[model samples]
Target: MKNNLLLGITGSIAASKTEKLYNSLKDQYNIKFVSTSEGLKYLDDNFKINNNIISSWDNETGSPHIELSRWADKFVIYPATANFISKLNNGISDDILSATALMYKDSIYIAPAMHEEMYINEVTQENILELSKKHIFCGPKYGKLDIGDEGLGRLLEPDELINIIEKTKEKIIVTSGPTFENIDLVRGITNSSSGKQGRAIAYELLSKGYDVIYIHSDLINPVPHARNITYSSSDDLYQSILKNIKDVKKIYMTSAVSDFIPEKFNKKMSRESGELFLKLSPNIDIIKTIKSQYKDIKVIGFSAQLDDNLNFEKINTKNCDYLVINNLKDNYFGSDNNKIFIIDRDKLIYESSVENKNIIAQHIVKNTTS
Candidate 1:
């Protein structure tokens, strides 16, 4: 049987593209469309999909919202407007699309289109972050918007949407945040990693239908829809990996693991004893150990350093299939934006300009995985 697909169209200029999207999916899917009243204005007159389209509550009988929400195997909101997204998040079921979305419990794929400024507004972003927990999003790709203005609010192309909605799914592990080595009960050493990058990776993976196990430190929040595991020290992280390694296909080792662990004292050190000497020992080499023990599992290592050059030797030493590098010289620690380089053991494969961590993640995952 063909997959059931419900495409919700809202009031955006990109709704004109809905006919193309419908025609693209008709062969592979049992296609149905539900458009907000305003959405009907922008749709092309050439649309045969009007026969299958539901425009208002009165047009359909006996709770169409509930029926549509339950019927679709894949539910998408294409050309989702900022207003519609806000309404969906706040439970304002004032229209057909909003009502159906509110009734839909499964992950809804949202493709947004608006001005770049509105797309990037703090309110919209907050709504997106919150809703992403139980939904998927393809793009507002960077391109021409309405009125010839160009930025990142363009709707994704038909093929891009098809690829995302039908992409092969996999199980993978993603580690985030900084590992802390406790010196005593009161003091510890850790890096400045805020876990934003890893969160972005997990979010992207979730959107692509990857089953993600997210290992993160308590200092950062967890990615929704991922199986979140919290770790403190490097040893704790390694143990978490060991416990969850069964049937895992890949590991994105993005956490900033502490290189050295301080010797722990059973008793808390008083301020008077601060002058005493201490010993530091090298922490566990997690990636190397995992690669050695489970040779089939692909481990993607991450390195953050002040040097601009890619270190092929470091990647070789760790046995990572790909090493993602971020230059700390740019002073981007804990920031939501990043520039990155992806290197194999032999040479650099990809480099990204400074952008949001989510965008950076898409480049990294696409290159390394492909």
Candidate 2:
């Protein structure tokens, strides 16, 4: 079925590209162009808007904005100005895009484009938070501004927008981090892990253009830009993963799952003083479950052992397609330096210590693709 989309244009240098994008998208789907006052300034007087177009003019006979919002399966705004984004966040209804966006009941997305400073401002961040809270999708991968300033504030390209709209139907899922098995509210059985390896791998997958669903347990640094489901205990993590596994293509069990959990949880620990007796039980084996049931999905697991000699074949038998064996002698858990021996089915790839996760992530992606 041909999709109906409302493309909201806001003021930015990149707003000029919207007409070309509209033309391109028109070939595959229905296009309705709505522009902010600042955006219309750059456009022609009689801007060749066809019957498919929806102008924000309240004086127009039909309620074009409302009708267009209803008609659209998805609404997206490209070259979203900082001022326009702020208005949308605050429900100001000062412009057509913001007003129609407030009315739109369907999936909505925005592509923000502005100067580096404007994009990084607290107000802009708050606007982004507002949009996120509404469950509105955004971003094609974080990039710098069009003005060549470095940072995350770039409007997504036409191809990227189209790709996300299309591929969202069948997206790849990735999970990352360590799983703790709780004893009580205060105590838990956890692994010697910081979730660095898994986070790095997830980012690697994302960079290679894969949609990621990261179940984070122990995050140590700048969090990966993926759909995150946080859990503190192994049981919680286990259930969450099991629930989402049906849609997953590949299950990367990079989380250092706790093997033991307290069988007897003490709810009234403070009330009872003295020796406490706690029984322990094994947590769910995530990799094994995926391997047994979800045979169609590729399973990648990680093992951070204390072994000094890099014997990858022995480590590969741990039942993961790719097993990242990082020697504890180098402090692989929480430390920045990582020396890993990647064990694949037929080959072993060795990596030296590196500081940047991006570099390490690229290596992982290369191996996965190869």
lDDT for 212 (candidate 1)? 84
lDDT of 1 by residue, 115-134 (tens): 98998787887788688778
User: What stretches of model 2 exceed 4 Å from their correct place?
Assistant: 1-3, 12-20, 38-63, 71-73, 81-90, 112-136, 146-153, 168-171, 183-185, 189-212, 218-228, 259-285, 304-311, 324-343, 349-355, 358-370
Give the per-residue lDDT digits (tens) of candidate 2, residues 137-185: 4452334556575444556677666665666533445555666665676
Q: lDDT at 201 for candidate 1?
A: 81
Task: Report every candidate's CA lDDT.
Answer: 0.84, 0.66
What is the Cα-based lDDT of residue 251 in candidate 1?
A: 95
Q: How far is candidate 2 from the true structure (C-alpha RMSD, Å)?
A: 5.2
Model 1 residue runs over 4 Å out of place are 1-3, 12-14, 48-52, 70-73, 81-92, 102-107, 110-156, 203-209, 221-228, 266-269, 272-274, 335-341, 351-362
